[model samples]
Each structure stands twice: as C-alpha cells, then as structure tokens.
Target: MYAPQDDTTLLVDALADEPLAPGARVLDVCTGTGALALEAARKGGRVTAVDVSWRAVCTARLNARLAGLPVRIVRGNLFAPVAGQSFDLILTNPPYVPAPGAHRMPRGAARAWDAGQDGRLVLDRICREAPALLRPGGVLLMVHSALSGADPTLRLLRAAGLTASVTERRWVAFGPVLREREGWLRERGLLSADDEKEELVVIRAERPV
Candidate 1:
C-alpha cells in the first residue's frame, strides 16, 4: 500500500509559496509518483526526478508527459542518478519505516517505503549527501515521520553542515505500525504493538549562500 501520500501536495504547496526563482534547478529524490517534481516544473523550475526503481521512473516520465511538462526522470539510488550535478533546490519523501530485522516490504514498496531499522537509513544518507549536491543558497525539503520526528533529522542535517529547520507539519494516520522484533522495540520503549497510528513531519534545510 505505497500509494502517493498527501505529503506530496503539502511539499509542493510549500515550495510554490517560497516562489522559487524562475529557471532554478530542482531535484526530487525518491520521486515516487513525481507529484512534487511535476509541481515544481509547473512553477518554472527545471525539474529532475530520481528514483531507484525503474518502474517508478517510468511512471514519473509518463506523468510528466501527460501533464505536458518536461521533467527528467532518472533511475538510480538517491544521488547516483545525478552524480556531478547540483541543484538550487532538492525535495524528497523517503522511506522512513524502522524495520529492525527481517521485515517483509510489499512488492514494489521498497522504492517508496523501507528505511533501515530506525527509519533513518534514507534520511541520514540524504542529509549526508545533500550539501555536496546543493548549490550555495540551495534548499532541501523532506517529509518524514514525526515518529522519527524533526529533532534527529535536523541534527543529522546540522552534522552534515547544513542549516536546517522544520518548515511545516501535518497529522496523518497511516494505519498499523510495522517493525521487525516487536518485543525488542517494546522493551526499548521505541514502539508498542498497540500503537495504531503515527505522525509525519516535514522539514526544510538549507545550504548557505
């Protein structure tokens, strides 16, 4: 059940409101359905959407064509597809699931959901790499779980040498929680079996000009 979530629209609206400079270069990492990238393109940014899944990349390309926008859809893990290139803005909605062990992700879901044990695998990696890929004065916006929340994410960004902040937030209930080693999680008080829903947090960080 890795459908396009409402966070896509939320991120788009935020970026649009910022009024990105015309012709700015933008990157949308993990661009599942390409909603954010397409929206950025519509707002006058040269958008490039990258996904590790070939299928997702294809879907994004088709969606861009259908919407009559020129979005470059690339297939590679994180920044792999955009090596040697930097952007004025970068956006991502990465998989933030905290799978402690042998967790079974749904077919095709890994491309959209399935972070490492603490749900920070992709997020951490992105933060670590974003600064190098961002131009001076570039911005990065990401949507993740408030379960993991903004604190850890912002810490990682700062550690990566980027100035960061939480730009927006919204409450969303995505049904049951899925994690490997329930007893272990409970023992550590990280999660409980009875927890039915969780929160999502959207954060925006920047590379200094």
Candidate 2:
C-alpha cells in the first residue's frame, strides 16, 4: 500500500481550509491508510472512506478504531459503495504517477500509484465522477502530480459546473518509483534528466449552491 506522503499532507492541509459544517458528511475516495478520513472525523464530520483494496479497507478500519474515531470503511472502486449518497465534502489522493509501456491500469500494490502514461487514467475519472457525488454547494479536494496535467482537472471540474481552482502546491523530491522510472519519463519528454523534483497540487472544486 502507498503510505501517506506529501500528496496526502497537501490534501489534508487543504481540507482544513474547507468550511465543513458540523456533522458534515465526508467521503474519502481511494483512501489508503484512511488518514484523511480520520482527520475529517476528528473535525466532527461524519466520514466514510473507500478503497479498491480489501487490505486498505481493513487497515483503515483498524486505524480508525485505534484512533478512537468513527470512520465507515468500505472496499470498492470509487463511488460504487456510496451510490445514491451525497456528501458535503469529498477528498482524494489518487494514483497519478505515469508508468512505462502500454499504461495498462495497474492492480495489486502497484495500483497505489502506477497510473497509465500521462497519469490521467484515474485522475480524469475522478474529476468526471466526483462532482456528482457532492451535495449542492459541496466541495471536492483532490491532490495530484503536475505531470498529470492539473489544467485538465480544473477544466473538467469547471465544465462539470463547479467553481474550481488550485489551492495549494508543493515541490517534493522524486520518490523511489519515480527515481526508477526517471529514464523512461525523460525519454517520453515528460521530465528532464536533471529534474529531481515534482510539484504536487491540491485542486479544490465547489458545486453551486
């Protein structure tokens, strides 16, 4: 499982800026360690966290119990388990690293990151679907790598009728996976040979009231 990292921190920090009404319903898609969900619960929000990995769900459940927080944990692809439900806020830190070769969607542990080439495989889907999961005047906060095209995210969210913008950014050094794929990234002209860091961003979108 991908442990919490800079992208996670960026989203958590952005969540703090959101005006979550007391007992606001919150959803955390692709929740890994349930870190964001736990935080929302701590903030007095009713939180639900879902992941494709059963291990992730179990881990998140355990984490919530250990933390003495009430986080509903489910194992399913994004939005499936929460069908017909609306939340005041939605948060995600999905896989956004571009992979080599045919860019087939990843499974297992690799599913935590290995997004297909251009890194929009999951990010694009989230942008298109997440807005529907929000209650009117609700907010969605997503974190992704700059290589995955932040502009497309904003464009998609806005087209979906949400007021969207980048709220936070941070430059973080390449992690192990990125270091291993550095050569292929350069070959694809996505990165330069000397580039050792990547900028992660938090895109926040709000539905019209």
Candidate 3:
C-alpha cells in the first residue's frame, strides 16, 4: 500500500480551504490510502475514491472503514469506474515521476509513482478527461511535480475547456525514489545538478457554470 507522501499531503493541504456544498459529490482519482477522500468527507462531501491498484483500493477501503467515513472505493483506472457520473469536485495525485524506460508502466510499487518517459502517462489522461467528470461550476484539484511540466497540465485543462491555474506550489526535497534517480533527471535537463529540491504544484481547474 502506498503511504501518504509529500505529494499526498500537498494535495490535502490544497483541499483544506476549498468550499464544498453539503453532500457535495467529490471524486478522488488514484487514491492510494483514501487520505484525501477522507478529508473531503470530513468536510461533509460525499466522496468516491478510485485507484487502478487493487491493493490501493483495499487499503483505502480499510482506512475509510476505520475512520467511519463513507467513501465509495472502486478499483479502476482514472474515471472508468465512475463513468456516467458527474462530481462537484475531483482530486488526484497521480504518477508523475518520469521513468527511464519505454512508456510502459512500471511494475509493483513503482507503478504508484512512475509514469511514462515524460512522467505524464496517467496525468495526461486525467487532464483531458476531468472536465467531463465534473459538473458545471465544479473544480479539479490535482498535485504533481514540476518534473512533469506544470504548464502542460494547465494547458491541457484549458484546451479541454476548463479554466485552470496553479493555486499552490511547495518546494520539497527529493524523496528516496527521486534521490536515486537524480542523476538521470539531471542528464535529461529536467533537474539541475545543484538543485536538491523539486516544486510540487496544486493545479485548480474549474468547469464553466
């Protein structure tokens, strides 16, 4: 099971002050341990959490049960499990770590963090499909590293007909996985040799009313 990391914490912090109507429908994509989903529910929103990893799904369900919060846990990629449903808010902390190999998914725990060569394997899909999952005036709050190109995220959302912008950004030191891959990142011009910190940004996109 994936633990709550800096990216997850950053996403939750961004959701802290977000306004939610009572019983608002909130969808959390790639929910690892249901942390964000639980936070949303605590704010009085009805939450649904989805993840491609069955382990993650199970972990999230258990966490929700232990917390006594009502979060619908589903096992599926992106928005598939919730097709035909629209939400008042959407949240995601997807795999944005650039993998060195072919765009194929990394196996095991790596799957939770490794994206494609450019680290957008799953993030791109979310950026394009999120608007459809949101109701009018609904919002999407997604967190990812700058290594994945924050501007690209914003551009994709805007091109898909949503108003998007970076609402929060925090610089954090590289985690174990990132620290191990630091050399390769620098080789690819993604990170500077002297830079030990990476910027994690919370992107907020809203569907027009």
Candidate 4:
C-alpha cells in the first residue's frame, strides 16, 4: 500500500522533463494508485499501469476513471501483463527496503517497501528484464534507494546493451520503514549511526534506435 512519497515526486519531476510525444505509449510497472500513470496520460501519452496487488489495481482504475483518463490498469506481476508489447517509456518505483531476511520479508501492508536483505529483490529483476520491454529509442525511468545498490542497477542496464545513467538524485530523511530498520541496516553496514538520510536515484536507460 505505497502512496505518493518523495521518491514518487522525484520520479514525476524527472518525467515532467521528458519529451513525451503525443500518443507515445507508456507503461507504469508496480503502479500504486496510478499516480505516475495518470501523470503520463495527462501529458498525452497512452498509458497502461500494472500492479501485483488487486487493491492497487482497483485503486488505480478508480483514480484513472475519476480523473477522466484512459489508463488501462492490469493486475499482474511486472511486465507479465504487458508481454509481447513494447512501450516508448517505462516507469516504476518498486519495493527497495532492506529487510532482515528473505523469509522475514513483509507480505501484507509492507510489501510495498520490504525487499529482501540486500533490498534488491525487485530492483534487480527490473534491471535484468525491463530493457527488453522498451522499443527502439524508448527509455526506462526507474527510481530506487541508493542503499539498494544504484550503481549495480546502472551496470546491469548497461550490460543489457542500453545506455544507462543516473539522471537525478535526492537525499531524503529515512522514512518510517527505513527508520524502523535503521538498526539492522547499521548492522549490515548499509547505514551508519550518523546517517539519518538515504539517497534516491532516478536511473534512465534508453534503447538506442
């Protein structure tokens, strides 16, 4: 149940600067509440949003309808719902919290933030596979915590034959989830006693035409 937060705003800001041509296809993976999807639709992009949570799908659908936007909301894992199709842009803000253990990962409400130990559970897969979903000249704009290995994500994207770079970064104070796990994170050397903030990075990877 992730709602709009600083990371969301950062991604939206980055998106606002993109040159989205009219009717450009946009896919929002793990869209929670359709925030990014709606923003893209408002910019004249044909947008589709996918989520693993039934509740999130419902919320996004309702939000789109209420906003009078034609956003297709699908209930499925990342990329599954949009298989066999390509998009001009892909946007996502998946879970990246560094939980204690794999088995200790959150299920219900915390699924939005509790990624396994290294916090790369979902981020790694997105980097590994999302490049294939982009059409030639298309780009992916994904946002996640630097604590979750932002450089690794950039490397992964580059290895996939895409031009990748960190377009933006912001230092935000530890949110509730991060604050709660500060101790464990410190133990893992992912955080420090004086570290009260975490850096969020927006990674942009483009498939060359």
Candidate 5:
C-alpha cells in the first residue's frame, strides 16, 4: 500500500521549480497527508487542505505539525468545507481508480483510491467546481490517470471555462487485474488481459484572467 504522502516528493519538486506568488492563497483538495499544502506553505503561500476522510485530515494535521508548516487541514468532502472560498492556486491528486464491479474497497484503501467505474467521479466533479473556486487568473493543478487520456479531461475543463493542458506524465505498472475483473474489462473493451500497466498524467488548468 502506498503511504499517504506517497507523491509528496514529486509534487514538491514540481512546485519548487514553479513557485507561487508570495502571499498567494492556495488550497489542496484531497490533501492526503498535507504534503502539497504544507509544501505550499513552506514556499510562502497561505494554504488550506481538505479531505473526505477524517483520518486523513488528522494525519494531515499531524504531518503539517511535524513538518513545521502552518497549513489549515479541514475534514470535508471535496469543496464542501470551503464553500464560497476562492484561492489563487488549487492542487489535487484525487482517487482515480476505475472499479466497476467491486462492491466495496479493500479496507484502508478507500481514503486514497476508488474513483468511479470510469475513474472520473472525483475528477469530473473537481473540474466542474474548480472554476468557481479559483480567482480569475488562478491555476488548478491535478494529477490523475492517463488511462482515460487527456482529451476528455481537457474538454471538460474548457467546458468549465478554463484553459487546460497536460503538464507532466509518468508510466507506471498498475499491477495485474483480478481474473473476473479482467474478463469484465475485456468484455467492455476497457482493457486487455495482456495489458500490464498504465500511465499517470498530471494536468494543470487555469481560470481566465
């Protein structure tokens, strides 16, 4: 299982290379260990982190404290906790797994994984709501699977009135599919049994100035 802070290093490295304006307001949705939010704070942004899982919020709070970063960690689903709050920068690495037939997630995995059947539940919602929560000229950075590809995501972002683009990509082994799930996926033509892995796509979109 991946740790809550699994992608902290990569996210931090990216942000460090592209620093936000000083005193910028930032939000990290699905802030699984507060890594992005804390890192943003460290870089001089006023940061707020939100997550659906209570445990994740607690862990994120502890992580911020341990890292000596002052980030506000809130427990709530998606943008609900920060309704009417807009920010200069928003970042998220949401749950993006396409599990069709699974009745329930493996115990501990629910907090970090499980997108919808097409792996777009959280992603779609975020895209739809992001424009409203971003100040004009603000940016929204999101990391998700390339399995669904970038076209649809870009289309969604545009429809939401934001300009979007692929910022980074990395290919990684997603592991074997369960036998029954594999058969199901093949029937739907979503995947082949021989397919061994997938790619992760990081995208960044910006609200118009």
Candidate 6:
C-alpha cells in the first residue's frame, strides 16, 4: 500500500473546499491508507474506498475501523467494485511516477507509483472512466506531479465532457523516488539540472447537471 505523501496532502486540501453534504456518496479510488475516504466520512459523506492491492484494502479497512469512520472498503481495480454506481464525489491519487517498463500489473512496492513510461497509464484510465462513475453535478478531484503533464490531465478531463482545471499547485523538493530516477527523468526531458522542485497539482472537474 502506498503511504500518504505530498500528493495526498494536495488532494486532501482540495477536498476541504468541496461542499459535501450529509450522506453524500463519495468514492476514493486507489485509496491509500484510506486517508481521503476517512476525511470524506468525517465531513458527512457516505464514503467507499477501493484499491487494487490487497494490502491496501486491508490497511484501509483497518484504518477506517480504527478511526471509527464508516467506510466501505473494498479490494478491486478502479471502478470495478462500484459498477453501475454513481458518486457525488470521486477522489484519486494514482501512480504517477515515470517508471521503467510498461508493466501494467505492478507488484510489491512498485504498485505504489510505478506508472509506465510517461506516467499516465493509470491516469489515462481514470480520465476515460471517471465521467461514467460520477452522478450529474458530481465532482472529481485528482492529484499528481507536474512531471506527469498536468495539461494532459486537464485536456483528458475536458475531452470527457467535464469542466476541468488545475485547482491547486505546490512545488515540493524531490522525494526519494524522484531523486533516485533523476538521471532517467533528465534523459526524457522531464527534469532539468536547475529543477530543484517538482510541482504537485490538484485537478478538479465537475460534471454538468
């Protein structure tokens, strides 16, 4: 299971501005440690959290139980567990690191952030699938690093017929993952020598009523 990180914080901060009413249906995809789901529950939402990793599912369920928050934690690929169900809010912090191979079914710790090649493998799926999961007037909030191309994310969301924009951005120093792959990132022109920080972004999209 991916531990909560800077990207998680950005998404959580964005959620604070969202107006979730009592019993609002909220889905947290790729939920790590159930942080987003728990927060939504605390804010009066009927929350469900899903992750492909069994460890993630177990950890999230345990966290929700310890927090005494009523979250429906499930183990499944994104959107699979909630088929035909729509939500008022959808939150995700999927894998976005530019990893080595095109390994779709990532294993071990790589499951946390081993997005293949350009780092949009999981993100693209989310974009293509999220609109169908949202109720009319529902909101989707997602977070990732600028290296993953925030513009592409906005474009994808817009193409999917949602009003999307980057709602929040923060420049954070390179974490261990980025630092370890610095040379490779430079080869791909995703980073530069003077680039001391990576921009974390929270993208918000709303489905039309």
TM-score of each: 0.87, 0.97, 0.98, 0.97, 0.87, 0.97
Taking the tens digit of each residue's C-alpha lDDT, what string does model 1 give over 58-153? Answer: 888988999999999999989998999999999998887666552654346553666766777788888888889999989898988766557988
After superposition, the stretches of candidate 2 with alpha carbons farther than 4 Å from their true spots are none
Candidate 1 global TM-score? 0.87
Alpha-carbon shift of residue 94 in model 6 (angstroms): 0.5
Give the Å error, residue 102, model 5: 6.5
Q: How close is candidate 2 to the true structure, as a TM-score?
A: 0.97
lDDT tens per residue, model 6, 1-209 = 55788888888899999999899999999997999999999999999999988889999999999999999999998998999999999999999999866755677878788898899989999999999999999999999988999999999999999999998999998888888989999988999878989999999999999
Which candidate leads the pack in TM-score? 3
lDDT of 3 by residue, 66-180 (tens): 9999999999978999999999999999989998984465898998999987999988999878899899999999999999999999999999999999999999988988989
Off by over 4 Å in 3: none
Structure candidate 6, residue pairs in collision: none
Name model 1 segments beyond 4 Å from true: 100-107, 176-188, 191-196
Q: Could you tell me the C-alpha RMSD of candidate 3 in Å?
A: 0.8
- lDDT per residue (tens digit) for residues 155-179 in model 4: 9999999999999999998888887
Off by over 4 Å in 6: 103-105
The runs of at least 3 residues in candidate 5 whose Cα sits more than 4 Å from the true structure, single-residue gaps closed, are 1-10, 102-108, 175-187
For each candidate, the alpha-carbon lDDT, in order, equals 0.79, 0.91, 0.92, 0.92, 0.78, 0.92
- What does the lDDT read for residue 111 in candidate 4? 76
Q: Report how far residue 7 has shifted in candidate 1, in Å.
A: 2.5
